[model samples]
Target chain A: MQPTGSVRPGGRTARTKAAVTEALVAELLEVGYAGTTIERIAQRAGVAKTTVYRRWGSLAQLVVDAFADTAGAQVPLPDTGSLEGDLRELGRASIAMLRMPHLRAVFDVVVREAIHDPAARSALTEFFAARIANGAAIVERAVARGEAAEGTDPAEVIRMVGAPYYARAYITGEPLDPALADRTAAVIALAAREGLLLR
Target chain B: MQPTGSVRPGGRTARTKAAVTEALVAELLEVGYAGTTIERIAQRAGVAKTTVYRRWGSLAQLVVDAFADTAGAQVPLPDTGSLEGDLRELGRASIAMLRMPHLRAVFDVVVREAIHDPAARSALTEFFAARIANGAAIVERAVARGEAAEGTDPAEVIRMVGAPYYARAYITGEPLDPALADRTAAVIALAAREGLLLR
Candidate 1:
């Protein structure tokens, strides 16, 4: 699908946008965000620089859109009619996403830029929010199944279970580990079953 | 305190280390990490450059040491008899730490280096790991008091709760909000008690 902000008549159309985005992703993975430019993106995509600027406003926007496009496809949350099964599936998928080298490079650049660039930060947040929202929907389904408390907050749970993996990837500069994901899922599952502790 | 790998030499005790560390921190805050050199650190500390270099081999090492030194004397965790209270205490203290502009500038540089430089990434990891470990210890105490689950991974929980705040601050170049910290603490507490939903 075409990005919301990237259409101008007689400019790069939906098809060219897709091709340009793919080209951008390849260049980003090869040269990183600092080296990947509109010129490079156009040459790689076999499109003109005018076509690129006509579609996306800046290199940053193109990078954000390309990253999102790469991460757009969502894995279906497992439905074994059990919360444990659901968590395991969700956790595993998250781990896999963090392990994608191309996406990880994009994520690294986005996060670094996010610290200083408002537009980049907004794009990163938007990307994360959408993914987490999808995970939350799956969790809400579990809550409705009576596997979890009615008061369960899927978004918060996503933060609880998935945040650590992201932290490890960014903070520690490590690929995601399935074992860690499993452990995190278990801990979150336990918390859902038992209420918060009190001294 | 002197870094773990450094050797203890003639006449310099804990107090001297503290003084030197303080000097280094001041310089780090005043000048960004890249700008803070061994010569500057020695001059600021009223010690010889050889002394500073003898202890820490590089500026990255010195910066890491300075960070550890500055973050050493945190407000002690409060025994509020509730998970929420304990977490709030940690959150407040953390926000206070992140608010120091000089420190924030250093942090921005360090995080950037972490993304691009292997040695810098290692130093940053070590720096972050200690803080995460300290936070876990506080959580563990709460767990022992039955204020949190015994199985609660304090390190993971800290990462989960800490991620968004840092993400926002890192990406937006903004200060952590006290209210957001409260919300994070509340969500973490809830997740600890009710368990998060995962489908």
Candidate 2:
């Protein structure tokens, strides 16, 4: 009844959390957000229903936590010594991550859920805001190095680099080939050089 | 048991279809894709359940048809003699359309449905492809007017013009203002003028 020797300290708790998060993602992919259930996730995770219930409280919370666990991993900012090179690297990484089948499936569900669920929407907004802040550093470095305009909007530069690829991938459902990353980086770099991105 | 004077020819059939489509869209916006039911749609439309079933057969079909009906309206291609003017018009139109509450709700449902349903995905793909094709004429006319390079990819140019706005509107959940549309048009026109969009 007590989850059998689950009284172990931090190590076991971390392991249980990881297992539950993994199961939640797998269940989400298999059954979609509408069909995913806390009971099913508990069974799949090999954890007690009460444990899951006590920890997450609801399926929505579990999903947001799972998404944060997976997507919240630190993406190393490129320090390639040039604004163009750094943006190219960032764009490549962003597109490649979105292209992954598992990540794509997760994004589809999370974005749809965010449409109607305020909590999910807030979580997603926070996730993207964090990413944008992280990427803004690249533009800041460029400005310091005299590689970009002094007044360039760092967040706008970052958004420009990833915008085209995300549009193709999510909005229009177009094929996202490697060339798109290159083009996106090139266009943003061109715009920044022309002082178009300056605030 | 036949209904009195209910046998008008094509006019009645057209009216019935119009009513059913309206009901389907309203239901989708009200309860979302998973919750929308043919029975409810029929009830709201004042049509018999058998009529709904006989016409649409399934929710997926009904949704796709409804989407096509709504989005299939002609979006007149811009021909302002200059690529910049034309692209600006197109971009503004696209942003305005997406900002509409009704169309936004329909897009939210269709895009989410497309993720898990093959029928919905194909329908969306086809719809977008047609739109891209229609918008491509702007580039063609620009080329004829000597405003763009001969090798400019029409579809690519159109995509570029719309990509940033779509990205802001949907992916990053950023605010879509008129200024964003102007900037999108300017960037794409600049890139195309530089022959970067040439195949």
Candidate 3:
């Protein structure tokens, strides 16, 4: 079911963009990147082909926008008063986001494209850079509170927190459990305290 | 050029298999997975279609075999007497392997296929399992020599050693530098000493 007659901030234009992005994601999961086309997405979204073309311009741009939209929807950073709590929340949120089938499908395509296509690679780089910046803020708060070392690089710390879980899930094909999130948080916290994440 | 007159240990069959596998890698790099076909591979390998079919049986199997062949040719684990030294060697070797254009192309295809295809997933799982097992042996040697904690999970330790570098390479699209390898080895060694890698 599509949302119609919605009175929002950006009105019909925002609704139309949302509809098309949603349709793009569905098309991606259904037929994969190679089979996904602007025509099919426009048809699925019940929007005019020209509208889809005028808005996104290219399939690569559309795909990148869809990925960015999904990533932007992730839960905001938690302020649980401690570095450990913040990292645990981040890890849990990451695992939860990755568990969604639609999101995982979109991410799989993005990662594959990022490896091969320059546009996709740059899009993914920008997306993660934003996420990493958010993660850095959490580590900065921890440092100010004296929970972590002074010189610990926030971005590097965030990367360490994520690396093991991602390596297991994407690379080694290991089963991702809640315990992994906890262990990842603990390992990063320990490494941070030991000044291993210093720039 | 095709080698016709070579008489080696496994002779023509082995040589033909190697040639076909090599051709498959080249085709994968040139046209990617979707464009690679048995017909083209057979042609490029200078072998008949029937020969290719009868030997590898399927394109999936052929791709898996090619990955296996390349992985098996990696440098053997170093016995540097210390866990840190062995891990550094492993990290350096992994970065070097991932830097090669041909190997990176093959790995990219395998990783993408593994995400979408059941057969490729299984092949990749098995391949990584073998690699992790080798890394475990190195850790086990360290444990025996008291370089690491007694109860460390060797596989987990190895995963820690690889996670940061791979997360940067594949996830965040960060540059894979020598410093990353050294830092990864140091962090894992620290984590191992702290008994964080215990099962």
Candidate 4:
């Protein structure tokens, strides 16, 4: 029976894809990526196994898609009328994302796999490179607004803001904290004021 | 059948334990911690399998000992008449050690294992905490000498100096270049001069 004014088959497919994606992420968080399987995803999503296979070629592809799918729209660069405000907001948002337990687990799996898999490594690197560039753009905007000095290395500047969190997260195995975020932002802002990178 | 100057059979056994420890580290580098085994170590070191069991009760214990055996003395804080000189030397030495692929492989195994094993994680944390304290002592000495400002958060200061190279190694999956080390040292020195952190 045809329902009147029903959307096209493409809409149904898109819904299915979204359901499968969410299910994959949920399963990943629950069971970990190593323990996740296509069949399990099918069971969780209530979708046919064949449908999952026909859409994504492999489990790695599915996991990668699931990761990329969860990335939020770039946190709007804080334009609170000042560069420091903007940067502080950016740092807070970035730290918040890194602190997410589910995402951190996914990051752990993907990065561990990346050590042995060239393709995964490339994908992860490109993903971060773009994110770093997006962050640099915020710093550049600040410089344009005269909040930051001219010719600041935006990538390096952004790196400085994120470095402590990543170091804590991956090295010391400590949770990134809001207090750290504030201190880092303060340090970077001071460095920016002095144009510390410049000779 | 002891040679002249051999104390006793027990002394020979101690020699075997030292040989086994050295062999374990070499094998860990060659095949990673996961692939290493007590029997393989005995074969490689030409020690009886019982010797390994008698000294280290488990693989984890053996690995902990091997790691302890291999770690050199902490890089001495250079008071080369200047804080910059001291930190730069420390940075250079750290870069040299971390850049060693064999050491990094062993480190990667330990870190991954630490994620799943509480005992390993505790041991690993203790190792790093001690290392951090050692580095902090150098900064403290610098402050005492008036080369650096007093009340500098030495741990945080060291983090700032060392974070970039490690971020590259663990996060970016990039090589730690000598040029990058030079620039990082320069930045840390500049920040020190500006009293970025209280001594």
Models ranked on lDDT: 3, 2, 4, 1
Return the interface RMSD of the candidates, in order shown, one decimal each. 4.9, 1.7, 1.6, 2.6
Ranking by DockQ: 3, 2, 4, 1
lDDT of 4 by residue, A39-130 (tens): 99999899899888877767777766566656434646566776666667877886887878767766766665564456667767767676
Candidate that scores best on lDDT: 3
Q: What is the lDDT of residue A137 in candidate 3?
A: 88
Better of 2 and 3 by TM-score: 2
Lowest lDDT sum, 10 consecutive residues, model 3 chain A, at: A1-10
Fnat scores for every prediction: 0.24, 0.41, 0.59, 0.27
Give one digit per residue, the lDDT tens place, for model 2 in B1-199: 4333346665787788789888887887788766889999999999999887877778777777778787778878888778888888888888887888767767776776676777778777877788889988888887787777789999998888888887776667788887776776777778877777887
Give the per-residue lDDT of model 4 (tens digit) for B58-129.
776777655655554454566666667667777777678787866666666555555545666666666666
Tally clashing residue pairs in candidate 1.
Answer: 13
Selected candidate, larger TM-score, 2 vs 4: 2
Off-target runs (Cα >4 Å) in candidate 3 are A1-12, A27-40, A48-61, B1-13, B27-43, B48-62, B73-75
- Give all candidates' CA lDDT scores: 0.67, 0.79, 0.81, 0.69
Better of 1 and 4 by lDDT: 4
- Please list the residue runs of candidate 1 whose C-alpha ends up more than 4 Å from where it truly belongs after superposition: A1-12, A53-58, A71-75, A195-199, B1-88, B99-102, B133-199
Per-residue C-alpha lDDT of model 1 across residues B1-199, encoded as one tens digit per residue: 6555445654455555666777766776676454667788778778778777777787766556555555565546567777787777777766776787767765666676677667678767877677777777767776667666557777666666676566555532334678766766766776665433121
Q: Tell me the lDDT of model 3 at A81.
A: 90
Model-by-model DockQ, in order: 0.22, 0.49, 0.55, 0.30
After best superposition, candidate 1 residue B41: deviation in angstroms? 16
Tell me, by DockQ, which candidate is best: 3
Q: What share of the true interface contacts does candidate 2 keep?
A: 0.41
